[model samples]
Target: MHIEIFITTNYYIGCFFIYFFMLYYCYYFYNMNRKSKRILVYGIVLLCVFGMVVVYKKNSTLPLVILNAVRFYFAGNPTEDVGYAPVSSKDFTVSVLASGLTAPTRIALTPDGEYMIVTQLTGEVFVFSRKNGVWNNKSRLAGKIDTSVLGFPPEELGLVGAVFSSDYADTGNIFFLYTYKNSEGEIENRVSVVSLKERFGTLVFSADPEVIFTANVPGNFSHQITDGIGVSIEGKSHLLFLIGEGFDAKRAQDLTLEGGKVMVIQADGSNPLGVRPYPSFPKLQAVGIRNAYTLAQNQYDARKRVLIGDTGPDIHDRIIYAPFF
Candidate 1:
């Protein structure tokens, strides 16, 4: 019904404009003629009504009719090609290194594409390096990682998302967002920046990661969620962090604990250099989200928005438009 209305509206508007132009032309051809003027005006009005009827008929959909048409259309057709040429499945065998890992939630690729990082549901960030056109695991960023201050409940936790510095090919800086313990020994969601060390030209994971910004947000492990990490292209200090509510729906509105917010901050884990801080607490971008899973900037538009695939109770999966900074 909606499609029919839409198509009808567009078709009528188009036909009306065309009819009006023809009426004006007839007026030009027969100026001050009463019959010609009546014909012109009546003809155009009749065309409009007829157009609506025709468009309604053309756009209307009947389930049974459509099903029969589809069945007949494909009944004797042997050609697989309809519009696009088909490609044989055996023609390509592209394989990724971390396909066997369970619940590889997020992936990060270096600026040079030489290395890739995969975060897992088990709280481990697995590093994959491209060597001789093939990828291999280099290291796993896990173990000895504090969870209490980083904001996760005393349940099983693992790495969620990671990002290499836009200048990592030159600066070797990388950051990871996960659940960890705070200063008071409480689990929380937070982001941390760590400098990757190049030992003999190989990247190695570090345990003594630099605490850039440990969010003081309070929440249980199941309530805190940070899904994706990406450095802002505008400034090295500016970083985009995706905040969300975990599978547990009861804690979506907890703002003090960074439950559903996009926290943006510096590389050293501080607010913008000269900007006055918010009264609520640390620096943050737009808040109020369900579960933001992906953060990306449009290459052509330079607009930034988080791709939130929220877990809902029998609701449609939505892709929300989170405005750019």
Candidate 2:
């Protein structure tokens, strides 16, 4: 089944009201009594009038959300006695399952390998689980956690990383890494941990996220930016992440600003928590890389070697075997 996304002008109209509500609420609270109340009401009315103007203008211009659908086809022989493995076979029934997901860019399985956490770039975390051999719909992980509050640009920010504790079977701690844009037009890399519960065979995750750590990084192109994050092997509240150099690769040389660098920290502590400098690590672990978008521990390695896929300039792609020194 093919899914489609359609744009609407009311989206901006709704956004105006939301922005005005926040602004007016503060105005109403700062100065009490009839005067403030009147001001707040008048401001809200003006915002409503402006919202209609924006809605009408937007509706007159564009009405369809840009969308793209990718289809994958297996290309090999299907016969058992024949050549290469094929995507279609009698024993291997194939079907395309669709989830009502809006640009789900990242997916990770729980440490128990029982639950799948899918993150939408549009500020939504959808959790899927298998029960009796059936995949269920979304179990919202970070429901309505406004990405705008993090100061991350909507086009550039996303729930980028999710992982379970190495001891998740024993401890229910789950970790997350996402982008937030502040009012200063700076992007922040945020991390947190939460627990999952099986309520009467229904897997439910926590709503109130416990912050683990946060690092501010600069933003590049809305689409070309690169970032990476993952939990350490030992799971002693440690995390590893990569910040990109973006358009200016030289900015990574500045340590005071976490640009084009890998950062390590303990999640169970305060800001700047037990941070280890990325430059101090082994040079061979990472070399000639501009931006890294994905990070993971190689399960094949006995020591669980850290692997990074750094998206290089032009069309270059570098996969580095990064081991913690």
Candidate 3:
């Protein structure tokens, strides 16, 4: 709860527009006309009396920091300006708990929230079960190490990233950041941690997998390691990942090279909580990044912030706000 971390990059990402600038000013007063709907109904009656004085001052982190800024919105900017509003809020409701399931990507929950640890791009790892609230039973974490995404650039690389192990529901263990081949075979990039269970109902991997770090790059297949998201702060669990400069991108502005940045460690399997200076990354927290494809953490704020959606090389896609001290 003593989270303070800071570092910025706001070409108008001005710290994530202070949480969607009031939902893009309520999406410009929902296409105003009737005197801007009475000034958007007096700004929703002064935001329902300023959210009942911020929920009677309990301020549960300002409504989970606007629901983690609408679950860290991911679409829109198909060249903004044609009524740029990518946040709709009917008090939120977006469904589809399960589907054809393949090439999934990322989603981890279990910090005792029942379960929901999906990840795929041809490396698989599913596990639903939200008790009765919809998420269903879709198990699937079968074993196999030395696994590589193998999905090849079809929408970009495989096994992008995965996390879980801040006591993964009593230590089912998890963590991986694809693309292997080490021991001098070249194809670098790995981040193990394995160990899982639940046999009969499906969910294997109770052995090999503890290589927690690696990097050699030149694998050149797309920014490779994209997420790890597991932060603890006071309890000390840390694992915030991202590394995709494999295509060289000027060696991610060279900080003794580890490509891109945001790579921390010690996610409950201790070691290396050191060195970080230059463009930093010997456990660095932030640095000239790109391809920040996925990372959105708020942890009920106290500024535990970790939102980094930075992707640029054309059309500046900023939103880098790492916080933790």
Report the lDDT tens digits of candidate 2 across residue range 1-325.
1111222445565666768687768765666788877777787777766655555454331121111111112333323475445476866754434545666667777765667777776556666777776766646454433456322222456566666665566656666666666687565656666766665544456456676655445554332223434454343545566666655666566555555666665556332333343445421123344677777777788777778787766777788886653
- Model 1: lDDT equals 0.59
TM-score of 3: 0.30
Model 2 TM-score? 0.61
User: lDDT (CA) for every model shown?
Assistant: 0.59, 0.56, 0.63
**TM, every model:** 0.58, 0.61, 0.30
Preferred candidate (lDDT higher): 1 or 2: 1
Q: Which residue runs of candidate 1 sit more than 4 Å off their true CA positions?
A: 1-91, 94-103, 121-123, 137-144, 148-156, 181-185, 246-257, 273-282, 302-306, 312-314
lDDT of 3 by residue, 192-258 (tens): 8876776664466788777767764544445657786766555656677888776567767776666
lDDT of 1 by residue, 110-152 (tens): 7777766666655555566777876765455433334433211
Quality of model 2 by C-alpha lDDT: 0.56
RMSD of each: 20.0, 15.4, 18.6
> Model 3: which ten-residue window has the lowest total lDDT?
2-11
